[model samples]
Target: MSAEFLAELATLTDPAGILTGAATDGYLLDQRRRFAGRALAVARPRDTAEVAAMLALCHRHRVAVVPQGGNTSLCGGATPDSSGQALLLSLERFHGIDDIDADNNTITVAAGATLASVQAAARSAGRLFPADWAAAASCQIGGALATNAGGINVLRYGNMRNLVLGLEVVLADGTIWNGLRGLRKDNTGYDLKQLFVGSEGTLGIITRAVLRLYPAPTAHATALVPVAGPQAALELLHELQAAAGDRITSFELISAPCMALLAQHFPALPQPFAPIPDWLVLIELADAGEDSALQDKLAEVLFAQGLDEALLAQHASQSRAFWELRESIPEAQRLEGVSIKHDISVPLSAIPDFIEQCGRALLAAYPTAQIIAFGHLGDGNLHYNIFLPDHSAGVYAEEEHINAIIYREVAERRGSFSAEHGIGQLKRGLMQHYRSPVELALMRQIKQALDPHNLMNPGKFLPD
Candidate 1:
């Protein structure tokens, strides 16, 4: 059956695009190595026409197809199932920047282009593409849009959904929907592009996108300040935003546990202070004007508020160093040990309360657990992760309990269980447990409407 499907796929794709054996290994596994999927073949398409033809063939053969990008999905969204019955579709060859309209502040980019490439293109045109994450170098623009990713700059510029003006999608039946209108205001009808933006390829494949750009920041000021706790950190966030106005581009919350993991694993990295503070907020301010005076304004606000213990970056290297420390937390944690991770968001006002309550609850339930909490506090999203220092026997068994305790608190405060990460294979069960019946039914209805045969990334996002 697989051979027959591959023979048909070869007719639409080039010889270089087909991968039969070991070549499909990279696309078969996820970034975290949590899920090892199997694929009959990896079909790399050069353009939208090839992709459409390939999908049409797959649909005709009734063979499942998985849309893969960089395979950097934390939730196993791009990885195929273990059945070896699916074809992994790769978009690497469709690499091109179709257009860069500097006058309109928009760029037309292919889905295979990396986020870093997009950022560099925007910079080359004297503009900025604000959507960024740690995996920008390897993650593709298509996956980012599919996941609706949010990163450091989400506080100022919005997520992938907000930055995207239009998209070119290949629907389930291999029909092309070219809605790549770069206009800012178009109230024609239902925003069709949005349906596939965060759809995770369950509905269709994103072939190209029209991304919005911003004026590049000419000045940058970054600072690392110590705080007493989450409450104090929230207070500092408010103060800095009030003083710096829209210049406050990033406000990251780093917990003491995260600092310890960094110190223990990555000793060579520069420490923010001699003894790490219990809590720290890594703040960054960017401005289009060269003489924004961001550093002076930050100093004034911190000193006036009696939060004087701070480290300010006077140069570009120092600013990078500060960001380096913040960015290295994930790697440090991975080196430290296994952890139960979560991406959650709450009301800006309820962040402090949520942290305190969730921490108290988790500690009471598992005494040896350490909360390695950190994330973009300015956007009210936290990577609330848990690690057991003692490595108890039942730690892994309590994964469900840990998730329930945290998600229950999130529900009480009207927060999201999956913040920036999309509900891929990892969180599909959680979606079934948390989402209201009506919401779940609506999603299934849409999925059936778009891909009634379920040949497009069958076992992801929506549950059976």
Candidate 2:
């Protein structure tokens, strides 16, 4: 089987033995290292024609394919399972960019281009890509589109779904679907370009994409505001929305305990904010109009919030210093010890109650368990991770029960178990347990329709 498949691929692609061995050191494992899996080989295809040939070979040989880029998935989405039946298809070398239309504000790029690379290309062309993620340096555009990633700038520019205009996907049968049109308005039959976005690479392989661009912001005003709690933060979000509207680009919520943990782990950076406060909000304002007064509007809204105390950074450097406090929380927590993470989301109004009740429940179960909750509150998403103080014994062993405790509560509140992160193998069973039968059945139908042989991605999003 190996000889037949390698010879077939070699006839159609350069470096046919590229699927052999030792090329997947960093690309095979995940960030958590919780889900390690085996694969037949790692296939690196530099162009769409090569991708089609590889897929055709895998399809004929009855081998499962796992499409991977940057290998930075937080929820084990990109990594395959221990079953050696799967093949890892890495698209990292398909990095090409073109400024198709400067006046029309559109750019086409190969799917493997890193987010930072695309953003830099846009900036060099005097435009902005607008979609920003914390892992921009490592995460590629293909992975971002597959997962429909949301990040800090989502408040104004929207998620990956909103930024994409067209896609080029290779079908399950090795047929290339070249739907890469840059038209702003086209009422064509299917609008099939959207079918691949957010599909988690199940429908097909996204080889390239056409993206919309915006004029670069001429001015940037940032602030780090302190609030009493989620309620105050929500109230402030409304106030800023009414005042600055689209100019208020990003509004983030950070908890006092989260800040304290960073100080505990990374002592090099002094903790600027007091820890007694309950919640904090990081506000960033930007405008394309060079004369826009975003700073004055932000200050006015924060001062009007009589219930909360806010500290706006006087300069861009100071604002970034404050933002670093929030960014470092995840890394510091990782440095501290093992943690059971839940990338969950509730309604914008239900955030405070969710946090309060979940913390109380954890305390009731195990008082020493630390509940580290922080994320993009403006968009109604929070990273509610559980950290145990007694890391000496059976810490990871407690993951199953801890998940049940939190997930049950999440189901009770009608919240999403996996919000921004796609469900790889980690939440497979929970999805079946919580999702309505009708919803699960529809997903299965879609899966069967697109990939009848179950070759696209065998066991990731949908539950068996």
Candidate 3:
């Protein structure tokens, strides 16, 4: 990067506009610390105008820009490459809730606004912005939409892509595309906003979004049910969904290893059941009415299905406690050690077979490996992670093998290699192998159309 360019970039905003040296350290490192890269400078623009000006300068100079949000990407999506050539464009300053249209059931917020903040804003208005994840407090709205993040509530409210009604994006050429319409029934022409939602910032920079909101649930019923295996778990899910219908907000599957890890790491947390079941399902129901018979419905379904082992949360505290266990699984896994993680999804009916077969194949190849399986069961997504006995030795030696086995099986079952987590740098290779030629070409064509110079998030989502 030239001094003249840096000087011009600095003039885009006030003091502290561009960061370097020690100041750039945090922006360069991702949440997972998997991809560390150098940046020409960390550009923190104050608002959309500054964002446009900075991006325009980068475009003029042909400098690659990586649009980063909270930098909470698991796949190192937000992290720049180690080439020291790309400009790290940070949206941290664009944190503002512009409007909350209760009548339209939509809230428009700046892209840098954290998910938790948006949720709080919705709650303040007696509405629910339901796209939630463990990193809600830190993950930004731009990152969420860019990755189309799917969380616990995905089965009910859908992913960030589904929740978005409109978007304000800054194109590669720094042209502002203000499609920030809050209307739900716009069918005039092409839905261009969809292009940037899950493009992982490669196509354009997501500056703002109009997100759909739902009526605040007045009551919640949560439960932890132990089952024999995935088959029994799926059967129970069928029974519950049959009984409770759309009231089922969350249905997560937890393997025994996950529960044990929780027990080991979080000793203070109560072990809900005696002799932790090898397979437990965390179920939750939510409704707008305070007098919802969710508990009674759950009990009836469990009893009728002969699922004898169950623990229903009797109060709000217990409900929160039950959810705390589900939320702690990822952190516990991180503390345990490095592992080959897969955020893949299969059909609801194929989950049992996929799990059993995949487990058998993985164990056959690497006998000492531990499969710490868990995820949103309601949506058929599984965090099918593998922890080797020697975590250090296996990640390098067997990661490819493990991913090959798992993803191949997923493909066989007509499943996706990258489910909730977008294909950033981590799964870009998989995108090449698994994605068909036509689909890949279409994606590349779109990337080429919007970002002809390939300056926006230079090397992510799309293949090299």
lDDT of each: 0.89, 0.82, 0.90
lDDT of 1 by residue, 1-464 (tens): 77787787888867998998988777888877778889889989999999999888888888888998878888889999899998889888887899999999999999999999999999999999998889998889998999999999999998999999999999888999999999899999999999998889999999999999999989888889998988888998888877778888899999888888888888898886868888999999999665347678888888887877888888889888888888999898778767878999998899999999999999899888889899999999999988887544345678889999999999999999888988889888888778889999999999989999999888898778
- List pairs with backbone clashes in candidate 3: none
* Top candidate by lDDT: 3
Residue-level lDDT of model 3, residues 131-240, one tens digit each, is 88899999999999999999999888889889999999998889999999998898999999998888999988999999999999997888898888899988888887
Question: Candidate 2, residues 1-464: lDDT per residue as tens digits?
Answer: 86777666667656743665666566678887877887887888889998998898888898789999888788888998887778888898888895557788888999899999999999999999998867989899999999888888888888888888888999888899888888889997887877777777887899999998998998877777778788878888888888888887788888887888887888887576665466778888889654336677777777777634566667778878877887888898888778888988778888888888888888899889988889988788888888888653357788888888888778778888877777877877787788999999988887888789999977787878
Arrange candidates, best TM-score first. Answer: 3, 1, 2
lDDT of 2 at 98: 54
Query: What clash count does candidate 1 reach?
Result: 0
The C-alpha stretches of model 2 lying farther than 4 A from their native spots are: 16-19, 290-292, 307-309
TM of each candidate vs. truth: 0.98, 0.95, 0.98
Candidate 3: where is the Cα deviation over 4 Å?
none
Which segments of model 1 are wrong by more than 4 Å? 390-395
Q: What is the lDDT of residue 84 in candidate 2?
A: 71
